[model samples]
Every structure is written in structure tokens, then in C-alpha cells.
Target: MSDIATITAAPIGSFTAEVFAAHLASLGDAPAWWLERKRAAYATFASLPLPTRTNEGWRFSNLSGLQLAGFKVERVDPNGQLLASPFGPAQLNFINNTTVGDGAGARAELAARGVLVTTLSAALQSHPDLIREHFMAQPQKLGSEKFAALHAAFVSDGAFIYVPRGVEVPAPIVITHAASGSGTAVFPHTLVIAEENSKATVVDHFVSVSDIPHSALRTPQFACGANDLYAGHGAQLTYLAAQNWSRDTLSFQFNSTVVRRDARVQSLNLHLGGRQARHESHSQLQAPGAFSEMLALTVADGEQEFDQRTLQIHQAPNTKSDLLYKNALRDRTRTIFSGLIVVDSDAQKTDAYQSNRNLMLSDDAEASSLPGLEIQANDVRCTHGATSSRLDPGQEFYLQSRGIPKAAADELLTFGFFEEVLSRLASEPLHDALHQLIKTKFKQ
Candidate 1:
């Protein structure tokens, strides 16, 4: 098997054909079908070119900062402790795509209750059929198909959760993906399968260990991650992802959600770190009475850029989807939000709404929004809108008159603005934890 040094001379970044061969060799005794899938994914990744400024899907994105070269894939030993989360005890931690810890002490009980929480590698061997059925099954309708293929080619292990029918997990399952070494590239995958009438919540945290200082020549890190959420009939699934990579990391996250008959899925993403980050979310209501609620909050500061793209497809009649994305931009940061809602010809009585709101904190910051809708059914009700605004001077003055400092007043106002999204969460603890995470980002 070839190592990183041997493949560094190849032209296709660190993910050369030689590197892919070595990756396949590392997965000893893997099934033939899975291996073939990886080979095909790598081929797809290699054939696609990087996105250019002319691409409509990548409009207003900082295409110059996008780089697929110079990053190496290597396992990093845990150097420091993983950040603690107040969510619950069921947690899995990974450093450089290698599982380091599994804290699900309630595993036995969960297992008895027909809940399966394990690493992707383990699930591949133990539950091959389930893994094959839903792993990266959704198409990359939004942009970032190349990155998604790269993730599938290089992904080794991640969190895999399966909740059987009628089982309701009492607590949220937490998964942490941490990058440790400089120039290290990690592919994180999370697949949650909630069977009919089941209920579960999964939270994912992406962080960098021993983060390098922003003043120094920051080493470039790469993180390409994806998650698949499947909610069966009458099932409920709630997913929350928090991304806080290092200051120099280039991050890409793709989410695909499938809501079946009478099922409901709610997903909220918190973007707080990385020099350049792109997130694509696609939610499909495949059956009647299905509903999807998509929410996101981004804090872009100090030259950071966050690009978000979303698509809501109503495939069946009486389906519903609602999307609300808000961003707070400061300094010279930039943010882009592009979203579309599609109602199929047979999807009558569909109700869909999309909104993008930005709060500009600095005159130098830039925020771009594009909201659109495609309705083939006349009975559907769909609406899309975008708005960019600054903090209200009256609210600032009112807070100042109440003895709050200028900075404190601004923070309070921002929190008040964000509370609209956070209040939707049923778990108050998770909401508070996310609120504190946003506060910490402001201090940095």
C-alpha cells in the first residue's frame, strides 16, 4: 500500500489514484460490492472539474479560495481531550476519521430497545444490507457533487445510527469529528435511519484540536462531510450539526433528508468556524402528509465565508416544507444563500415556504441571497423571499438607556434575533448550548 509521501507527487491533490488504491488496501477484507462502489466514486470525483465563477450554482461564491490540493489523509492520534457537550451521554468521538471513543453507556439498553449505534465500519460488517440501502443513496441535486464523491471515496468510518420502529430514544446521540494534524483531510459521514413510528435525535460536532493561531501562517485543513437522514412512516427525526473547524480549514457539508408518509424531520445547522465553508441541504417529501422543517444560523466574521444552498422537493400531494436561514455577518466576512422549492405536477395541495434573512454588522461585510420556486401544480401554495438588514438603532438606544454597554446591547440584540430559530428546538438544553457556542464565536 502506498503512503502519503508516495502519492504526493501525483497531480490530483492528495487523493490521487495511487492514494485511492492505498485506501482500498487499508480496508482489509471489505466486501467486494462496497469496494467497487468506492472505486466508482473515486472515478466520478476525478472526472469532475472544480467549480468556476461562471457556474450558476456557485454564483457569488469565493471560487478563488476553493482548493482540492495539498491536503493529506492520515490518521492522527488524539493529542488533547475532546470538547465536552451538555447534550447527553451517548457520544462518539473521531480524530482524523478514526474512532477514538464511544461513550454510549446506555448502549445495552438501547440495543435491547432495538436501537443500533455504532461506527460505519462496524455497521458495514454487522448490518451490510442496511448500510448498502441508505448510505449516500440520495443524489447530489444541489452543487458540490465532486466533493460528495470525494467524501464517499475517502470516507473510512463515522457514526451510524439505526432506530427500529416504535422505539423512541430518550436522549440525543452525539457524534464528534475532530481534525488534529496540519493539512489533514477528514471525511466524516453520519447516516441515521429511523424506522416507521420511531423517534430519535442526532447531533454532530465538527472541531479542530489544538487549533493553530489565526495570526500565524495557518495550515490548510480539509473537511468533506455528509449525512443521510431517513424518516419512515410516522417517524420523527431531529438533526443538529455544529461546525467549528480551524480558522484555515475549507469545509463542505451535504445533507439529504427523506420524509416518508406522515413522517416529520427537523434539521438545524449552526455554522461558526472555517475560512471557507459550503453547505448544501436537500429535503424531499416523498409521501403525503410528510413535513420537513429546515433551519440554519451562521456567524461569519473575520474574513470567513459561508455558502449555503438548499432544495425542497414536494413529490407527493399534501406535503409541506419550510426553510428559514439567517446569517450574522461582521468585519469583512461574506455569506451566500441560494434556495429553491419545487412542487411536482402530481404534488397538489403542497405547501412550501423559503426565506433568507441576513443581519449585517459591518459596512464592509457582504451578504447575497437568491430565493426561487418552481411549481407545476396549480393547487400548491409556495412563497420565497430574501432580505438583508442591519441592527435597529432604536433597540440599541433602548438597551443603552437601560444601562447595557454598546457591545452588550449588540449581543443582546443578536441573541434576540437568533431566538426565533432557537425557540423551535424542543430541547432547551441543546438550545442553550448552541447559544453559548455562538457567544464564544463572537468573543474570538
Candidate 2:
């Protein structure tokens, strides 16, 4: 076989040319434009090489354990369970890339108000032009271009939401991406387009179905997902993603947000599971008065590795952005956070802030942070910092003096450390849910 043929003939990690072809064929009668795009994307994915330890972007990442060969692309018939609590106004549940839950009522209600909440495939058939215009429109500024290409080439199904101008979605839209079956690979996508003066909130949940023990050999799943948010002039958009994949799963999530003139966006990511997980987020202030608030919380335990990278770009004058990330590390877990803020020459009066804090609960746990800035404008107000500290001994002692057990007291202190980032969410329900999730992680 030739070089290209050999690479495409067999499984390369979890993706091969044969698998890509099968995925495309499964789409049966998709739009020609989209099909062509997938073909091109596959070509790109096959040609580019994976990240290496020497790459600056992949620094501090667990490059040794990154494997992609044993997974297969197939439909998984998972016994999926919907969230116990009320998710939101609209909830779409998926089992291995297939929407399995009923969202008819929510869809009907939104349809009456000119909102579109449905599967990406349906959107392509009904609104091809809109999908074509904004699908993966933002540049993948962070690393993981190769994986992004792989996602575009093999993505089978996901959620599509659109809010027309002047409409405000009273309740948030929810999408659940669940994976099951041993050695299964899934690609979940979420695309949101908010028109001028429109407002909406979207929450994405990533999970894996199966009661397998948290062992390296018992469970292994591959997840590559991406989300795009486009806020038109004066629009308001809020997005949240909570990932709790299987402990033996390899997961990747890429996010891009574009804020237009006078528009604002707030995004929060809660990380709780995965053996080796990497998340990349990029936010762009495209026009003046644009503002973006970025927040993230993570609970790293056992031998898990959580790698997060972010970029904030002030492309226009008078734009602003704020970012706060907090992580609690226990056992031998490892976490990495690298963020950068860039201001263009004309982006004067750009007010930006970035901070990452880690609370170490174990002496062996590892945490690394790289926060930087690039400014071509002299009149910009930008500040960035990263901090890693252990639990305050004095506070722990004080709690113990009050009759609280040492273990419970430590957990309380961790919650207090995370409350700073959790309090930024305007939705009380979301805040509470996240708190409960973190609390559960500690109990485990």
C-alpha cells in the first residue's frame, strides 16, 4: 500500500480512513456541501501529525499515555438515563451520537417563537445556509487542530440551536452527550448562533454510560467534541459544559466564542471525570464594547490528568474580558492550566484579567500554570496571575477545634475555595448542580 493508503487502510489510534469512510456513508444523503467539507477535513486530519512533548502547546501534557488505536466508530445502544433534576427548558439526550430522548414539547414551544432547537442533521436539511455560514467558523487558535479535523471528518450527530434577533430564551437549552460500549468512539457537536439583540443560554453535559469499575483495563472510550458560539451585535450568550466521562475514557473538548459589537458572553466549564482529558477554549472580542467572562472548576483525583488551555483576544478597542479557573487536586492527580491574553495595537482601553488557582490536597499531586500576555497597545489595562497553594493549616485546625472531623473540615475548605468561581454563574440552579457534582467527587 502507498503511504496514504497504508495510513487509511488500518486503525491509526482510534481513527482510520476506513472508519472515516464508514462514518460518511452512515450519514446517507447528507448535503453535498457538508460531505465535501468532511472529505477535506479527513484529508487534513490524515496529513497532520499528533502533538508531541516538544511542542510548546503540548507542554506539561501527558503525551506518553495518549493512544488512539483500539477504538471503533459504531452506534452504541446505551441504557441512557436522563438527568434526575430538571435540566432546562429544552433537553436533548444522546446515546453514542444518537438523540434518544424526547424534546418535542420544548422544540414546539421554541418553534412558535422563531427559535430552532434540533439535531444538526435536521438543521442541515432545513437550514443549510445557516449551518454552512457558522459551522466551525472560528479559528482553532489553540493546539489540537489535528483532533478538530478528526472531529469534523467523523462527527455523526449533535445539537443545533439558533435564536433569531430580539428573542430571549427564558430557560436554558440542555444537550447531553453520552457514550457507552467498550472501545467506542463518539464525536459530539453543539453549534449556537444568536442573532443581533438575541439572548440565550446553553448547557452541554458529557458523560459515559456503564457501571464498570474505575480501572485502566475495564473501560476505555474515546470522545472528541467541539462547540461554537456566535453572538451578534448586542446579543447575550451564556454557555456551560459539564464533563463526567468514564474514568478510563480519553476525552477532548474544543470551544470557540465570538462576541460582536456591544455583545457579551459568559462561559463556565466544570471538569470532573476522564483518565486523560484536555480542554481548549478561545474567546474573541471581535468588536468594541464586546465582553467575555470565562470561568472553570475542576476536581482532579486519583491518577487523572486534566489539561486546560485558553486564549482571550481583544481585537477591537474598549473590549473587556475576565477569566477565573480553580482546581482541587488530590492523590497523585495532575492538572495543567496555560492561558494567554492578546491585545491588538488599536485595541486601546482593553481591560482584561486572567487568574488560575489550584488547591493541593496531596503532597504527590502536581499542578502547572502558564499565564502570559501580548500587547501591541500601550493604553491597555491587562493583568494575569496563577497561584498554587495547600489548605490553610490554621483554618483546618480551627474547623477541627469546632468538633468537625478533619476529613470533613478539609472538604469544607475546598468548597470554600471553589465558591469564588461558582458564584459567577447567574443561574442558581446551575450553580447548585455544579456544587453538588463537585461535592460528590470529594465523597468518592
Candidate 3:
């Protein structure tokens, strides 16, 4: 029987009505509309079953080790620091869904320009209609429908940003989410709406507390996060996210981008930490002359598992999209990449490309790739390819002959492989910071 058919009617996770009730109580007097939506979402989540190995979308994933127990709705005190700092003029620091610090100067300036840089709760009260229209508006086309519903049911606070028409922000907006306490479950959401002819950049950083007193006895955390990006006509948006969860943590991040006429959006995700991490990303070109660029880089080591699924949909004519994902594996780690490109019947003259490449640094590491395309338009040009390769022996030997250690030589080659994706970032500071974080992982 098919995986979807074999799915049991009973839910398989730890989420129950009691947990949902506790989560609702934590919100404390939120808008009625949002509360009603949450109740509906919780029902949906409870009805859906966990994904099994028989599911094609979850092929090559480590479903046997997937567990959703031992997590609770908890708050983390802010540590008065930004995990990803100095890259943006406007910044919001969220530790376990609490805002601890912000850039007042940048926020004030953006406010003067009629931009909205505030928390999701605040936006729901101040701009109820606007938030209702754009928040999680897109369908969860990927295989994370249950998780997406879970996010909506429990998510309390996150960053909300809106760029007005004809306005351009000089710097990026940063949102940092950190989990400090063990077993602290966090739901972080970022909603961005850029108006016509507007331009902006957003950075999301996920990190865990370092230097645990007991260290070895620390329990793992759970992070279920989502982001929605909407680019209006003639607008441009650039989004960057870096996930560095604790090594014992389990994380799920879903992303959706909608592009309008003459609009463009570029998003890059860097995955570095987690015992098992899964990411789902979908981009839709809703109008003519729209473009979407999707990029991702992952470094997996020490029995870690990174699974990524992506989709690009061309719903209109004269649309374009490009996707590139790269992964480097060491030790006994595993990585999986699955991507698809779809061109609608009316989406003529569409140009789409998808590629996934993996580099193996150890014989024990494993990587899987699945690339597909569906084109109903005869005039569309869509191409996809995936490749898994190892470092050239000659290059490695040459570096070793120059007194470089074998480990260092491999690290250098890995960096060279990843630079292709990192070089696309427009912000110098953000680029450098990402590079440094990758280097730290290599050192570890």
C-alpha cells in the first residue's frame, strides 16, 4: 500500500488538546480572529498523521529517529544580545519568542518612511486586515502540512516587517531567534510584505545557547519555524537565513515566496547544525515578468542528517526561476535533496533551472538527490540536473605536498565548493559572517 494510504487516522505526535489549550492560555487576550484560526489549525494538526517512509516526498529521510515528544510551551529570557548582529540597520532579537533588544535608530528611521518593523503580535493588533491577508496565505504545497499547522497553532511572537510603496531601505532587517533552555520548544515566524517598487533585505538567524554548565547532560531543543515573503509589483526582495541549532536538536523550517509582476526575490539558506534537520521551500511566480532565485548550502557531519525539499511554480507567462543547492558531507553524515519545477499551461516562455550538487569528504557519508520537472506549456524551457562528487585526488595531493594537513586540505576544498552559493549575497557583512560560521564548523 502507498504511504499516504497506510497513514493511520490517529495522530502520531505529542500535541494534544491539553497542549493546545495551554498554548492558547499563554497568548492571553489575542485577537479573536487569530484565536479562532489557531483553534481550527490545531484541529487540522490533530487530524493529520505523521509522515512515514512510504511517502515519496520523505524518501531517504531518517524517519525512524523522528520524535516529537518531551517538548513544552515555554518562554526563554532574552540575553540582551543579537545572534546575527552588525549586518542590518534594523534588528529584532527574539529568544524563545521574547524580544530582548532592538535597533531604535533604525526602527525610528524606517517608521518615518511609513515602514512597519515590529512584532507579529503588535502587527496583528495595529494592521489586522493587512496581516490577515498576507500571513501564511500561501498553501503549504510541500509535505509539511501538519508541521505548518502546528506552527500556526502555537506560534505566539515573531518579527513582522512591511515596506511601503516606492521606498528602498538602505540596509537589511535582522531577526535573531535563540533557544537557551533545554527542551524549549520555539516557533519563530517572519512575515515580509514589500509594496510596489519597494526594495528590502531580511536576515534570520537561529542559534542555541553555548557553554551549558553540565554540557554533556543538556537535552535537545525543538524548533518549528516558518517565513512568508510577498513581493508586490516591481518590488525586489533578498532574504538570507542561517540555521545553527544545537547538535542534539531537531528543527523544521518552511519558506514560501510569492512574486508579482516585474518583481524579483532571491533567498539563500545555510544549514549547519542539528541532529536531523528538514527544510521545505516553495516559490511562486504569480505574474508576468516575475523572477525567483532559490539557493541553499549545507554542511553535514558526525551522523547528522539534512533533508531539503523545494518547488518552483511558474503560473504566468514570461516568468523565470533558478534553484541551486549544495551540500558537503563528512564522517557518517547523510543529506537528501529533492526539487521540482512546474510550468502551468498558460505559462509560456518560462525559463526555469534547478540543480543540486553534493561533495563527499568521507567514504562513509551518503547523499541522495531527486530532481524533477512538469511542464504543460510547450514553449517553456526547463532543465534540471543533480550530481554527487568527491574531491579530486590530484588537488588534494597538491595541497598536501605544500605541507598542508589532509584535514585542512579537505576543508579548503569544501570552502571552495560552497563559495559559489555564498558569493551571491549582496551584503558584505552578512557574507563574511556566514563564511566565519562555516569556518567554525569546519574547525569543530
Candidate 3, residue 370: lDDT: 93
151 in model 3: Cα distance from truth in Å? Answer: 0.4
Alpha-carbon local distance difference test for all models: 0.89, 0.87, 0.87
**Model 3: worst 10 consecutive residues (lDDT sum):** 1-10
Per-residue lDDT of candidate 2, residues 263-340 (tens digit): 999999999889999999999999999999999999998999999999999999999999999999999999999999
Q: Report the lDDT tens digits of candidate 3 across residue range 1-444.
A: 343343454453556788789878888768999999999989888887788866788899987555677776666555665554534433777888787775667788789999888999889889989889988898987788988999999899988999999999868888888777778788999999999999998898888764454341245888899999999999999998889888888899999999999999999999988889999999999999999999999999899999999999999999999999999999999999999999999999999999999999889999999999989999988989999999999999999999999999999999899989988888888788888888878877
Mind sharing the TM-score for model 3?
A: 0.95
Check candidate 2 and list the clashing pairs: 13-68, 13-69, 14-68
Q: Cα deviation in Å at residue 328, candidate 1?
A: 0.4
lDDT of 2: 0.87
Q: Write the per-residue lDDT of candidate 1 for residues 1-444, one digit (tens) a residue.
A: 133333323325778898888888988877889999999999998887777656899999887677677888866666545656645543688888988765767666678787998889989999999989999998998878888999999999999999999999968888888887788899999999999999999999988876454531255689999999999999999999999888799999999999999999999999988899999999999999999999999998899999999999999999999999999999999999999999999999999999999999999999999898988999988988999999999999999999999988988888898999999999988998899889987786
* Number of clashes recorded per candidate: 0, 3, 0
Q: Report the alpha-carbon TM-score of model 1 versus the true structure.
A: 0.95
The C-alpha TM-scores of every prediction are 0.95, 0.95, 0.95
TM-score (C-alpha, index-matched) for candidate 2:
0.95
Highest lDDT among the candidates is held by which one? 1
Q: Which stretches of candidate 1 lie over 4 Å from their true place?
A: 1-11, 211-219
